[model samples]
Target chain A: MAPMSFAGKTIELDADGNLANRGDWSDDLARELAAQDGIAELTPQHWAVINFMRTVFEKDGDAPSIRRLTKESGVDTKMLYALFPKGPAKRAAKIAGLPKPKGCI
Target chain B: MTQTAEPIQKVSIIVSRGSLEGVYPGLIMANGARMEGIEASLFFTFFGLDAIIKKRMNSLKVATVGNPGMHMPTILGAIPGMSAFATSMMKKEIEKLDIPPIGEFITMIHDAGCEIYACKATVDMFHLKKDDFCEEVDGVISVGQFYEKAAGAQIIFT
Candidate 1:
């Protein structure tokens, strides 16, 4: 397990840099993680996606796939890429304090 | 051996078959690459153009006659409508796994920024014009143009 220090608190992370303990997650920690991923500020639109991811994870016990995020999250695929850049699904999961989604599409 | 490890940044996939099973592996790989922040492009050639052809894209069938994966006797597989039956069965299974249909899958990947192109030679051989393809197709290109676009990127043949 790797440990990351954020906002004077040390947190355990998995090999992929996702938070190891879901219980340790907080809104502040999400902001910190987003910052580390190069997002300067968390906009309302960002929160919409982060919160949607968290809500889905709570029920499904896994992060939603990119397809679900685009179809059900009120954010289209292009907008998702624009918001998260690079990899929206993986990066959004990391910032949302959820495990990496396993589906291919 | 002393070379440093570098992550893949781009992939250009060549799809040469048009069957449902033959086309999906390439589409899945391209979609997966895009999901990982890697740039991906798909080049459709020969029968692979069926995947982008407007009239055929949604109707791709499983090749029941010669496909051993179905474990069916070739004689039985050759029966009328056998390919359509197998294709429908596969579609049901795919739906159970939450996989979108071919048409929707193509649109989704295109929206996700995966580049799609058709081979000009194949288009000409089939007498297909650009309008004969689905809207998602970027354009038809020559092999030379494909090689140029694939420069510095990993090339995958499917």
Candidate 2:
């Protein structure tokens, strides 16, 4: 498959469809997302949760199971699901800004 | 020449749902935003808190009633098929269409530096301690604080 692109820029890829800019994080993404209702109000709990989600993606190239996320991050899965609505991996991936996870597709 | 402002301003979404159908839109939109480089956030409140809960996040079912256009697999879902099996099949189809798991998609947004918030009032109302939530959450905030962040940002409720 071809790479993902944004704003007239094609996503740079690695051998494994990995990203070229591993540390491409920018506050703009967060600010833009924060404008949305689901994400507008950030809390400490949410931050740790999303960050852990990113960590999982970075390490596994996939999202974490809720059980694993709770075990690893200590966030309440019940609560997380309530916040995400669409299953945590999918919801979190978008907010966290990694590519759509591989296995998810 | 008059300067043209950037179209497609950033917008954030708040999702508060416990059922499968309710959650899908939020997850889909958040990822969709990241795909388009728009900002997205998903704050869990009240019953919507389920997605953030680790153990229960996987097997969440969408309530059939009160949800229009939520097509269920009637033949398989009802006529002697395991609910788990049916649910997984449906989820797989969605995933095949590139729907990220709530957790994974949330991570992708964060990886791109999007915000995720938990509602403190909702947690308290539900009598949940902070220990009940995931570490990826930025922190807890009241609705007022949330609005402070949401100022000048597009707010969507899903």
Candidate 3:
């Protein structure tokens, strides 16, 4: 695990680089995380997914799998990949300050 | 720095059986690979082509007879409509887990950028044309081409 500093506040990250403390997450931190994944800007579609993931995790204590995300996140599978390339579920969860999804699908 | 094992970058899965149990493992593996940021491709051949065929893809049945996993006596398994019954039960369980149906799963994995291919020999033997398959199929390729695509990647046969 490593600590990253943003706006003079130190934030801890898990070994997978996901935010270690969910309470430490902020919109600015999300933008910085997305930028590290090569997304220069977070669009509305990205927030749609991030917001959905956080809402689900808040209620369920686990992030939704990609299949669930596609079905209920108001975003389709193809566009999810386009918006968060190379593993949308894993990437989006990381940016949303949630743990890695556990399901295989 | 500690030395780390090399991650799998790509996988080429070969689906050679048409049974509901046979085809699903390969599909799940291929889809799982793509979800982990690994490249994946599925090559359907022999009876496995039924998984991608337009007319049969959605109607695949579980094999009750001769399948030891069914946990039933062979004679009981041979009873009429047993396979359909088993397949329906299995589909229900899968749906409860929120897994998509086969046809929709194929489209989802393809939409996620996993390549899907049909075996040329199997397609020709079955007299299947390009249009005979679901639109997600990338193309029909020979074993040689499949190997070429499998180069530098792990290959899984199901």
Candidate 4:
């Protein structure tokens, strides 16, 4: 995947453009990636999903799937799509600088 | 002038198996699509009809006999009650994760705006009436109709 350069930090990305190193992630980096994904601004609802996904990844060793997101992220399914369009689990994970979620098609 | 990339607008999943393990992949994929802000649909055919039939949909069992993932040899997998044992284990694991049961999951998918369809040929072959399906079923449709709806959509078969 192409490298993403922002805020004077160049970060490697996986084939799907997720952060190659989790340590490379920051709120700034997430904002940049979210912009590239066509989300111009991160709302409180967006952070709710990103933070929930990152927390789940830290504890579970993988990002949450759609089912987990709807059931455990305190975000309803419709809002999840509105917050992270075209694939919430994948798009949110990418913007959150996490790996692609398993079973995310 | 440059052409911008177009977003995926829809996904169509063809679920052709009736096993407990077989059905979830399609459901998961469809749900994933809706979660992504895409329209989604599921076309159930053949033995997969069991996944929508009101009487059998909720009672799907994991097929251990021909399943290599079961880890048990086929001979041992055939032991009496093994299928039920595997089904119960799967159900327990799913519950442990707070995932809804089959019936509820189906309803959840429908409530989330995923269209559900039963194959007309399969319904006819099984002598099933419309009421025999879960109310979530949008319609009983022929393959031609399904393809018409699936046009320009990403198609997944599981």
Q: Score the docking of each candidate (DockQ).
A: 0.76, 0.06, 0.79, 0.31
Model 1, span B5-25: residue lDDT tens: 788999999999999999999
Tens digit per residue, CA lDDT, model 3, B112-143: 99999999998888888999999999999999
* Residue-level lDDT tens digits of model 3 in A1-105: 779998999988888888889999999999999999999999999999999999999998988878899989899988998998868888999999998887888
Candidate 1 CAPRI level: medium
For model 4, how does the per-residue alpha-carbon lDDT over A1-105 read when each residue is reduced to its tens digit?
888787888899898778999999999888888988899999988998999989999999998867777878788876777777666877899988899887543
Worst 10 residues of 1 chain A by lDDT: A62-71
Number of backbone-clashing residue pairs for each candidate, in the order shown: 0, 105, 0, 1
Q: Which pairs of residues clash in candidate 3, taking residues 3 or more apart in a chain or in different chains?
A: none
TM-score of each: 0.95, 0.53, 0.95, 0.76
* Overall lDDT per candidate, in order of appearance: 0.89, 0.64, 0.92, 0.86
- Give the Cα error of residue B26 in candidate 4, in Å: 3.0
- Report how far residue B11 has shifted in candidate 1, in Å: 0.6
Better of 1 and 4 by DockQ: 1
Give the number of the best model, judged by lDDT. 3
Model 2: chain B TM-score relative to the native chain B: 0.80
Q: What is the lDDT of residue A67 in candidate 2?
A: 42
Segments of candidate 3 deviating more than 4 angstroms = B1-3
